[model samples]
Target: MQTKSAARNIFFGGTIFFFVIFVGLVAHSYSYIVTTSTNVKTLTEAVAHGKKIWEENACIDCHTILGEGAYYAPELGNVCKRLGGKDAVMGMIEARQENEEDTRQMPNFNIKGKDLEDLAEFLCWTSTIKTQNWPPNEAG
Candidate 1:
């Protein structure tokens, strides 16, 4: 009688443990799906246009953004903030165009007005993404 009772208790306890784990996993998955779907709709038209420019220019070929590209140049994930602001970033780009020195050659794309604004907005948006403090330091 004692042995039978011990076996029944062990089986029931194991079943309950597995059931709880399965339920938790399902709940976590549902929450993740909902959150991701909501965030996906938050992307604006400017961001979409900036994405196209980034792609067309092959910016990732040299610079890494959020650690997803080549490492030849500085990571531009938080460049907007690092440069002080969106306008400052545009100024820096414009300056690079005017200077054109061999020491650091960032070719002037001649991006102007709305294009610059959209690009800057997209970069600012990228900087706000949660990356757990990627690039590890301001130097990136």
Candidate 2:
């Protein structure tokens, strides 16, 4: 019931409308990620160094952090809260002992000194991220 020119106008109008909606959604997502999903104030040198160490050692291969890695080990997203504090995390990492009775064991990566401290700091920082109650339990 519409002329060729009217049909063309409707098509272009619809395209523009959808494009604007898409742009608005993208902006919203970006703002949420920058402002709501993370705390920029807590990002420190120690946290960066710890993340670097985590990558260098391939910790993701055995453990899941924020529920992205393998499930072989306990989730470490909320490790700082669950384990008590940074000191407890550091202590656990420092004291890795192999037991024959245990079916699975965490191998000692020999992480120590400032590197160990940084790694713990990184995990503690990760605990502060807003995961919207992810892992669904305190154990994570």
RMSD of each: 5.7, 2.2
In model 2, which range of ten residues has the least summed lDDT?
Answer: 95-104
CA lDDT scores, all candidates in order: 0.78, 0.89
Task: Give the clash count for each candidate.
Answer: 0, 0
Q: Write the per-residue lDDT of candidate 2 for residues 1-140, one digit (tens) a residue.
A: 89999999999999999999999999999999899989889999999999999999989998899999988888988999899899999998776533446556887788999999999999999999999989798766
| Best-matching candidate per TM-score | 2
Please provide TM-scores, in order, for all candidate models, with all chains considered together: 0.68, 0.86
lDDT of 2 at 61: 93
lDDT of 1 at 69: 95
CA lDDT, candidate 2, residue 85? 91
lDDT of 1 at 1: 56
> Which pairs of residues collide in candidate 1?
none
